[model samples]
Target: MQGPARAVQPDEVLKDPQLETRARDLSKDLRCLVCQNQSIDDSDADLARDLRVLLRQRLVAGDSDAQAKQYLVDRYGDYVLLKPPFKTTTLVLWLGPLVLLLCGIWVAVGFYRRRGAAQGETEASIPLNEAEQKRLSKLLANERKR
Candidate 1:
C-alpha cells in the first residue's frame, strides 16, 4: 500500500491545468526558505507548502510569476531565487567560474613558460667537484649494478 503522502498530494487537484503548470515552473525556480539547498517544488517542508500556497494565491489574483517572485525577492532578498538574475550585485557569482578558468589557464601557461625557460638553461660546463664526483660515481655504479 502507498503512504499518506500519496493521498494528500492527489487531493489538491489543481482546477486549472495552466495554473498548475505555472506553479510548477515558479516553484522549481524558487529556493525553499526552510531548506535552503532545495527548491519549493522539491521540498516537503511546511514552509515550502506555505510558499506554494502563497504562489498559487498570487497567481490566482492575476500576479504574473515575475511579480510574485519579485515580491518574494523584495521580502527575502536574492537568496530566494535558485537562479538569481545576473546584475551588478551578483556579478561575482555569475563571473566567478570564468574568472577561475582564466586564472587556471594563465597559471598553466606560466608554468609551461617557466618549465621551457628552465629547460633552455645550459648545464654546467665544469666537471663535478670532489664530493659531487664521488656521489655521481656511486650513483652511476649503483645504476650499472641494477
Candidate 2:
C-alpha cells in the first residue's frame, strides 16, 4: 500500500501559530489546479505545495486573507476558489447541472407521454366482422367448457 498523503510539510509551516492557522483556512478554500476536485490543503501535488508556501509568504508579507486569495484569483482566475462567486463569467459552472437535470426531466416526460399515447391508440378496440365475432364466441364457449 502507498503511504499517507501529507498535506502541509514541516518546513512550510509558519512560525506564528495564528498565521499558520490563517494560512490553513485559506488553503482549504483554494482549489488545486492539478486536482480539480481537491483543495490545495488536501492535495499532495507540487503545485499545491507551492501554493501553500506562497500563501504563507503572503501572510508574512502582511497581506490579509482576502488579499492573499485575491492575488491567487488574479493569477489563476475564479477557478482557483473552491466556491467561486456567481458572476457572468462563471454562470455556466453554477447553472449547467441544474439546466441539464431540467432538460432530462422534460425529455423523460415527453417520452413517457408519447409511449402512453401510442399504447392508447393500439389498445382501442376494433369492431369485429360477423364471422370473427362468431369464432371468438365459439372460442369463449370452448374455454368455459374446459
State every prediction's TM-score relative to the real structure: 0.61, 0.80
Query: What lDDT would candidate 1 get against the real structure?
Result: 0.79
Across 1-146, the per-residue lDDT of candidate 2 in tens digits comes to 12223688889887787898888889989999999989998999999999989989999999999999999999899999999999999999999999999999999999999999998888675678899889999999999999
TM-score of 2: 0.80
TM-score of 1: 0.61
* Residue-level lDDT for 61 in candidate 1: 88
lDDT of 1 by residue, 30-65 (tens): 998889988887788888777778887888888998
For all candidates in order, the CA lDDT equals: 0.79, 0.90
Model 1 regions lying over 4 Å from their true place: 1-13, 33-38, 44-47, 122-146
Pairs clashing within candidate 1: none
**Predicted model with the maximum TM-score:** 2
